[model samples]
Target: MTKFNTTAGKPPIVVSDEDYGRLTKLATAALDRFPDVAEELQIEMERAQVLSTATIPEGVVQMGSTVEYHSDVEQRRRITLVYPGEADIAEGRVSILTPIGAALIGLSAGQSIRWVSRDGREHVLTVLKVEQPVASATPTVV
Candidate 1:
């Protein structure tokens, strides 16, 4: 089994209660098809500090948050973290079920984490910025 950095020394992570509930269901359902990734997601969920959606800090990475991160191998990249069905790598939307995605959830800007990829490659990613979704937007009717 791949061992991720989840010890006491690592930085803390916070997740919104709504996101946690959705992700937990998703992870549980994925266990039969993708046990490894599902297990990792479960571990992350278990270690996360869940809070009310309104109480979660603005900079924390959550579903639909656009994150700018620097990776050991990939340098810098900005990606929007989304659900499995919404994932489109070509469009820079990463799925929460992926290794990097699971590792990023609940982290705030400047927080760094080391995670192992499915192929057994270790990577360190530091979140540079987090852009949370706007709560309200005006609709333009054409």
Candidate 2:
């Protein structure tokens, strides 16, 4: 809680049409509990270029994508962006509802974004790589 930053003319973002509907619901439902982030996510979606899953080009950051990026606060991070239900920071899974996760959405390799942390510090991150989840990344059981 109490995370996220204000960006400068946020770069355009994209979302799978399939995910948009569910994400809309998520943002609306979270309004009561996590207003700031939920609202941030909602605002992102408002401008997102939603396309069919099949039309979504590779390397675009989508749900379940394992992205490698460098941020000002950290040297670099490689994590999978997941739905809130599946987020387990310990396992390198980040929820879409979190600040960083929300920022990572729709970004592709070589794209950078700037944001201000709660303490009024401005930070920038560049996406180095994006790997969409494969069937192997999902295992029904151990």
Candidate 3:
């Protein structure tokens, strides 16, 4: 598999210590489960810094401005793309463990990636934008 290259001239991203810790833990566990795969992911995740959407706070979204990548049969979808806390499929949020999620985790807007499907067709997508959760969007009783 071709490793995605990090872009140049990007600003440093900011992620909370807690979120960084969580990502580290998750990456560690993944490394144990899939040594080679985990090794690759570890390199990406460690180098990644989180940057949330305008609406969301840095601590809450564990996301960065960079794009991540993954490829697997449909069966591996759920495990790879969604966030650890956002595994509720009904909500339409995917774990970073999912292929698409993996492909998007560290990318910023305008970045693109290429991956192959089971049918041997190449697929590519660019980060049009990132919409992190915003604190103001949270409803609170007055």
Q: Quick one: best TM-score, which candidate?
A: 1
Cα lDDT listed for each candidate: 0.88, 0.81, 0.46
Model 2 lowest lDDT segment of ten: 133-142
Instruction: Tell me which residue pairs clash in candidate 2.
Output: none
How many clashes does each candidate structure show, in the order listed?
0, 0, 29
Question: TM-scores across all candidates?
Answer: 0.91, 0.86, 0.52
| Model 1 worst lDDT run, 10 consecutive residues | 133-142
Sorted on lDDT, best first, the list reads 1, 2, 3
| Model 2: lDDT of residue 62 | 88
Clashing pairs in 1: none
Off by over 4 Å in 1: 136-142
Candidate no. 1 TM-score: 0.91
Measured with C-alpha atoms, the lDDT of residue 139 in candidate 2 is 37
Cα lDDT of candidate 2 equals: 0.81
Candidate ranking (TM-score, best to worst): 1, 2, 3
Q: Model 3 over residues 60-88: C-alpha lDDT tens digits?
A: 22442222223333322222234556465
lDDT of 1 by residue, 15-34 (tens): 98988888899999999988
| Model 3 misplaced stretches (Cα beyond 4 Å) | 1-18, 34-37, 49-82, 115-122, 136-142
RMSD of each: 4.2, 3.8, 8.0
Residue 98 shift from truth in candidate 2, angstroms: 0.5
Which numbered prediction scores highest in lDDT against the true structure? 1
